[model samples]
Target chain A: MPYPEELVSPMRAELTRLGVKELRTAAEVDGFANGQKGTALLVINSVCGCAAGGARPGVAMALEHGTKPDAVVTVFAGQDLDAVAKARALFAEYPPSSPSLALFKDGKVVHFVPRHQIEGRAPAMIANDLKAAFDKHCAKAS
Target chain B: MGTFHHDTHELHGITCVVETRGPRTWVGRVHEVGPAGVLLHDADVFDEVPGGPTKAEFLARTAAVGPWPRHKSVVVPAAEVTSVRRLGDLSA
Candidate 1:
């Protein structure tokens, strides 16, 4: 069963406050995955402490990087079940793990950070990892 | 030949303090026990790092206060789990 909306609203706000688009329905997830043209970052947000302690904060920090994805989006795992399932289908190569992050360029996932990487890591470290991915995949030609 | 069955079924429905092989620890009620791992409901997963609360301290605080329900549900893989104890067993 999904969590209470009241319980997860604040958690959703953590990313929404940073301008991350929330994809709450499967249709929204499809729209983003199928229609986005440039580099986009998709986050599978969860209620785990790793998400609270690092994943969200890391994304927040990485957004400050000079080179960043054109779009940032998120789908809450337990709360937005349909959206999360649809989003995970885009990266079917990896196992399903919450609090995961994927970098997609022109509708293809180029970088993925699974939950195992997020756990036990600090926000700054996770940010660095994302920053590196952004530099590799999102950087524009001068 | 006799077959020995090991199961977390006894722990099901009971609130537990679970420790992973890595830095992560979880406190929650056991919801499922499968060959893959144990699923925890209303779990609070913590990572014990440098300058952070030790497992004992965290458990003590939890015993004093209460379980902080962060995760609605999470499956801790059997390969990663080290121990599982009833939260009620922890001394305050």
Candidate 2:
């Protein structure tokens, strides 16, 4: 079952406000994965406290960096089962973990940062980590 | 994994097939792909022989850094990479 609509409302907004396209269904994830050209960032958005306090904010901060991903998208972990399943399917080489971050180039999971990396980190530190990952995997628009 | 096939570039969670100096192909997650070189994590070494069989042995390994834990990742130089691909996709 999905989380109550009112519950994750703010959680959804946290990323949407940053212009991160929410992949709310299987087809949406399929489309995003197939349609991507060059590099894309996938955040396994969650409703955990760490997510609210750090992950979302960190992603927002990372986007503010001069360099940005060609496309940024996310899937709600508990709310959108199909979407999350499909997203995680793409990242099959790694074990399942929530509130994870991944980078894909031409649709391949090039980089991954698991929950172990995010659990206790601050938003700014997460942002810094993402920015560094972005600097490596993501290309700044010309 | 037959019928579950996919080109690594089209699939997610892929390994690098970097070719540097000799004919060695490396497998690992890609860190960065830039003009200078590609950085890889959790890298492993392999050898591909033309018209011959392919063999992958743990001939090489590296410690991961930063957000990437050393146990599951490594840093690899992708400058001279001849090609990159995923071994295959997971279940549908």
Q: Model 1 clash pairs?
A: none
Error of 1 at B53 (Å): 40
- DockQ-based CAPRI category assigned to the predicted complex of candidate 1: incorrect
Clashes of 1: 0
Pairs clashing in candidate 2? B8-B86, B42-B73, B42-B74, B64-B70
Clashes of 2: 4
What is candidate 2's local distance difference test score?
0.67
Candidate lDDT values, in order: 0.81, 0.67
The best candidate in terms of lDDT: 1
TM-scores across all candidates?
0.62, 0.61
Q: How does candidate 2 fare on TM-score?
A: 0.61
Proportion of native contacts present in model 2: 0.00
Candidate 1 residues A4-80, lDDT tens each? Answer: 77778888898999999999999999889877788999998987666888789999999989899999999999888
* lDDT, candidate 1, B1-92, per-residue tens: 01122563866655678888898999877777788888998788778889988878887766543466688899999999898887655631
